[model samples]
Target: MKALRRPSTAVNALLALLIVGAAFWGWTLLKDTDSDTGANASGLRTLTVEQGTVTKTVEADGSVESASTATATFGTAGTVTAIKVKVGDKVTSGQLLARVDDTGAARSLDLAEANLDAAEDALGRAQDAGTDTSSATNEVAQAELAVDEAEAAVAGTKLTAPMAGTVTAVNGTLGGSSSGAEGSGFLDIADLGKLQITAAFSEADATELKEGQAATVTWNALQGAETTGQVVAVDPTATTDDSVVTYGVTVSLPNPPDGAKPGQTVTVSVITGNVENAVLINSAAVTTTGNRHVVTVVGTGNQQETRQVQVGLEGDDAYQITSGLTAGERVVIPTSTTTSSTSNSNNSGPGGFMGGGGGAPPGGR
Candidate 1:
């Protein structure tokens, strides 16, 4: 009597499965509805058509460097006697920047002078001796050579600035000892008035980068200062650093305000493309079904048709459709409901829009 009839486990399991199945079915429907929130929602092989206008642009990065870099060193073998210019000193070309002790050099010069005098006296006496004076004149010439050598040594006692710039570094101190014949620089002089930017671009990006392209640069050193410049040069060879092979792009900075220096960190902006009044299509909407651009165009009848469009330049925010699509055409822009579309970049045809086929519009001016 106490044990009443109870439901079997198999019956309960069947009911549980029906409940779970319904929950999954409802979830799928909710996801599909979320994808279409507006009247002009987008989907695969589709683009939300935008108005048209032309565009111009390029993008790159680089650092600010000196136009002219000069390293001052010991002209002759001697301990550094004095350094006239310190870091940050504005020096002009040919200005004295450093001095090596002339004490030994001057003594050598005196000795040379004495020897020259002795030779002159000997030559004078030899002329008085007569008939044998020819060889004595040769001795005068040899002594004169010694004097010239001594004079040159004395001239090298001072280090002069080779260009108009600021002193950026002082290597060794006076009496600390250093022969600058090696790469060790006694002082560094850099012309900040003429700043240059050394930019690095990937091989793919380098195709868009070229000399004479306009650029804007910014630096942490010069707060609030935006620098304007142009691409001055491009390295023909590729350089590999940190596993990235890049081409060097040199940009000539406009005359910055006084106080610019070399080795300062700088950021450069090279706009790859800039567009105006462009037929703005969300990049996700455009799809490639093999050598063809499949864009969904919505008509006044609310019918969605997959239109074969001849697309053009592709960008981050929009695609440039040269043909196959018109201004104010309603193309469906893809959303989370579908996957992003690919482009037929390698397709060979006049009407084939390839390579993520949205490019900056062509400008007349």
Candidate 2:
């Protein structure tokens, strides 16, 4: 050492002041961090469980089609002389829809009628003269059969509607021979008022659906049109398309949207189950722990305990508590913010707290 010298009074006084200032700053930082930790520890959100309704549903999409449809083809080959009904015309059963050229058929009928009259006269004369009337009788019967055949040929040229429905297609042309080609049908008729949706559901979803179950139908084309319907039929056999197995579930709409035509696509929601007056809680409150449903419940004293629960009728947002939980119980709804804050507090360095274990400041009462 160069010399043993005492520090000046001013220098010693300045060092003392600097040490106190540094200590105060460190104290302020510790107090702030402690306050932050206390606030975060008590900041936990909770939800009160109560009675509510939950509806379990199965959703699928489908297209709307006529419940009953029919296509009328020509019965006989002839020139389409007249087409009485046009597309969209409502027709009744046995209504005359179209007619063909029956001139040749009429002529045959007339010729057959004349031959039958002559044969009857011959039979009457034979009976009056008593000369072998049996042969005349046979000739008259043959003439009667020929007339019936001619009448049938004439009737085959006319086309008629088989049922009462709206005409959807008309493929016949005037003066065109009824060759019955691809475009040769008289017309198509369908019962538009009675509509149905053939919805396809996956194998797992179809199992819960049964005939007579209620369903709701929606179509984008109709602008939020919703109609009540029921499941009319479910195909027992499954249909596979593009490696996906699905089943056809027929839902019938008793009253479809006005002007809703066939082939419009629709979505179907089938209600499988509805639970009422059940204890419900937020779905996030439920957690799976080793084959058990666990939920964290906060007691009156602000203490938390994990308990196993039985859930029923899972809904879109909440779940029904079947057992191990009751109405009016409070359940904890964990949040990311609270979790992050807690993690930061646990990972705090040695300097974070007033003391290592949140002890009082140094030299404090």
Candidate 3:
């Protein structure tokens, strides 16, 4: 039998080179196939026009606050002799909240009263004698004024609830100086039964908000807790912080759920515009050209036409089609193409479609 000859080094090297070339060719074909598949998958996405409700809303961060609040403090400076209520105590208007030493106040009141009595007696005697009583009458009037001031000072020693509310904070302690607490008063009371949300919204958002606009509030502290409210007021003036302008908006929460308290953060979404039973379409399908809006409509036999449309209230995700479109009509969302060549030419380095710095992302309109 003839001995089989082993392959030469040159032949073996050539075979290895051919194998590498075949593998590279297969890889190239596979990459091309994937690119074609991706292009097909991204093409011709369509949405059907339908009759529905479209609501446009403006969202803002806010905090819960009492609609009615009163800060109770002693009008006259003195040591706090009594504290009738503690933090969290419910109180009514005119209810005694705290008391200070009234000794000096009472003495001043008594002295004023005695002076007024003496001055009035003098006036009466002068009048009975038919002599000039102008000076005596003036003295009586001055004394009466002093008496009124003294009475007011006496009443000022006792701090009373100015309105019905729950005591949120007590700054003064028994035996402490009533005047020691400054700025915030001795007691902080808030009408917890009546709550409202105060939010600062951007100038653009505030323009759309008006009194009586319906709103929904969600608490951050309370998981999944939400309630309805109404726009009670919008500030005419703008508040500036770091040169950024915003307006204050107040929303009344007629009936808030339990656990909602003042200072708790909340999210407020006010429905600025709403339309029911209107023809609506995906906002992405509409493109603005100059001053007109247009959409790509797909009809029978896959016929496509670019038609001008009248756009109405634009919502978060849907747009109200005022005209030029009807229910059951299909509209195409233009495909976003980002090939390697295009991406390199645009200098948009990786993550082509989104990172390209193009128009607003899908669903952003």
Model 3 TM-score? 0.77
Error of 2 at 343 (Å): 24
Listed in order, each prediction's TM-score against the native is 0.68, 0.65, 0.77
- Across 22-50, the per-residue lDDT of candidate 1 in tens digits comes to 99999877766543322332333332355
- The ten-residue window of minimal lDDT in model 2 covers 348-357
User: lDDT by residue for model 3 over 1-365, one digit each (tens)?
Assistant: 12333456667899999999999999889766544332223355565676666678899999999999989878998889999999899999999999999999999999999999999999999999999999999999999999999999999999999999899999888999886466679999999888999999999999999999999999999999999999999999999999989999999999898898899999999989877777776565678878699988877776889999998888765678899999777676656522432332223111111111122222222
The lDDT of model 3 is 0.80
Candidate 2 accuracy as TM-score: 0.65
Global Cα lDDT for candidate 2: 0.76
Which stretches in model 3 have alpha-carbon errors above 4 Å? 1-42, 337-365
Itemize residue pairs with steric clashes in candidate 2: none
Q: Which candidate, 1 or 2, would have the higher lDDT against the true structure?
A: 2
Indicate which candidate wins on TM-score: 3
Regions of model 1 farther than 4 Å from truth: 1-38, 41-47, 52-61, 110-146, 178-182, 220-225, 255-261, 272-280, 289-291, 335-365
Q: How much is 287 displaced in model 3, in angstroms?
A: 1.1
